[model samples]
Target: MANMNTLAPHVSGSTFGQVIIDTIADLRDRRAQRAVYRRVYNELSAMGPRELADIGISRNNIAEIAKQSAYGL
Candidate 1:
């Protein structure tokens, strides 16, 4: 009937809205993780070779270390 047709559209609209909200939330989380990765990488890169060696981190591994620290991978 007419009422059923109207109700179906409303439900579909609500689901679409939820999908948009979820996408935005996912994007925000990814941006935050990327910021953390960049910060850690920059700080490590600024250290001298001797300082890095003191901490057992080679310059070549800075990106991997930062990724692990940020994304827990």
Candidate 2:
């Protein structure tokens, strides 16, 4: 017969609950990151073309720039 091993106290439902909480936190972080991206994009897009040109960021690269601004990766 195979021995049934019990999970340690830390690995039990308490841990499961913590994992769920961690997942929620991670999701919130991602949501906030996306929000940052959107906000940056909108703000940048509102600038006149000459202003954007002065900054050297093209209109096409706004999304990528926003993502980088949000995540730094």
Judged by TM-score, which candidate is best? 1
- After best superposition, candidate 1 residue 3: deviation in angstroms? 24
lDDT of 1 by residue, 1-73 (tens): 3545443353454775676687789899999999999999999999999999999999999999999999999
lDDT score of residue 43 within candidate 2: 99
Steric collisions counted per model:
0, 0
In TM-score terms, candidate 2 sits at 0.75
Please give the TM-score that candidate 1 achieves against the real structure: 0.79
lDDT of 2 by residue, 1-73 (tens): 9974353344455676677787789899999999999999999999989999999989999989998999997
- Candidate 2 lDDT for residue 9: 43
| All candidates: TM-score | 0.79, 0.75
Worst lDDT window (10 residues) for model 2?
4-13
Model 2 clash number: 0
